[model samples]
Target: MKNIIYVVLAMLIFASCEKPNKIAFVNNGTLINDYQEKKDVEAKFQLKEEAFRKRADSISQAFQEEAQKGQTEAQRLARSNRKKAEALMTGLQQKQQQLQQQMQVEQQQLTQSFQSEIDSVIVNVKNFVHDYGKTNGYNYILGTSDAAATVMYGAEQSDLTQTILDALNADYKKE
Candidate 1:
């Protein structure tokens, strides 16, 4: 009976000595939005988009001028050769269609490229968080966003969004 009591006491002491699991939660939206690398990536893409828009505008203006000249020449030909004028108009229409298709393809490619870069940045941020959790001895780190709240109510003490953001920005500055 004394041995049993001693064993029970030892078990209780061991259990009490075990460390509790460390868990934390971060706001997903805030973490990503406030990341310095993400902001720089977005700014770089914005400049590219602006430059693309200017080039597209210039191409459109040049096409318009060419079309106007074609129309004038077609009208002049119509007085002497009606069939030739009709063929010229048809050629102009085909050219316009080709330009529109090319522009659409360019725009789609640009959008896809932008999305890919953004996705990569998001993955990097997630990886950083994962490493941070591991380094800080976190057993679990929940992510909550306004769009999808995985963590509905974490205590302020357990919220590591700002802390993680600051660390992430500092890491980015180093890079």
Candidate 2:
């Protein structure tokens, strides 16, 4: 009977010694938004967007002035020279189309450039998170954002947002 009791006690101790799975969660919104590179890239893109808008506006204003001038000359010519005024108007329309096409091209290029850069930044952050989990012995790392939370309920102790963010910032500084 004493041996049976000892065996039961040993089994209980061994079971108690087993560690639970390591898991943690990071706030996705905080991680992405607070990241320095993301902010800097956004600022740079905003400046580029503003400059392009200004340039397009200037071109548009010049085209408007030319249209107004053409209108004035057409009015001065009367119905006898309607054909000449119509031809001038056609030429003005072509110029406006060209200006619009040019603006569209510029906007597309800027958007692609910004999107590619941001995508790369996001990939880097994801890799950092993966490595962090592997190095820290976490079985899984959950992400929570405003849109959705991979981890619906977790203890505050299981939150690793600050730790991951600090590691990420440190990694960025080295680069």
Candidate 3:
């Protein structure tokens, strides 16, 4: 009777020790910084901005040259041309405003997309980590990458940033 009671107590203790998994980490900053998809979007936005500036400069230079040529007829024509230039400048200003708005929208959308992609990958990795922890019987699994004090010392093997970035790029390539 004593032996049977001890055995049952041991079984109960073992059962109580078992649990499902919970995972936490600090991959958000790393995901935004290292993600290739986000980098490409930024590059395209820069190219568009540079092209817009060049076109605006060319228009302004043409207007200045016309103003510099001084004859009575030329002055009269310049006055008329100046009004036209002013109207065109207004239109160009409006276009620039529209382009800036478009760029903002694109930036917002790209941010949302990168977030969605990272969330999905995090979910998959969480599932994997849960399995890994359960199999290894780790009651607590911590991401040293998320540690404070400048991440003083973490094994490169444990960083997991490169691994996650690779997964991100692979998913991007598939798309």
Best by lDDT, which number? Answer: 1
Q: Candidates' lDDT values, in order?
A: 0.93, 0.90, 0.59
lDDT for each residue of candidate 1 in 12-87, tens digit (9 for 90 to 100)? 9999999999999999999998898888888988998899889989988998999999999999999999999999
66-158 per-residue lDDT for model 2 (tens digits):
999988887776577888888877888898899899999999999999999999989988999999999999999989997997778989998
lDDT, candidate 1, equals 0.93
Order the candidates by TM-score, highest first.
1, 2, 3
Residue 30, model 1, lDDT = 94
Lowest lDDT 10-mer window, candidate 1?
33-42
Worst 10 residues of 3 by lDDT: 66-75
Off by over 4 Å in 2: 1-19
Ranking by lDDT: 1, 2, 3
Worst 10 residues of 2 by lDDT: 71-80
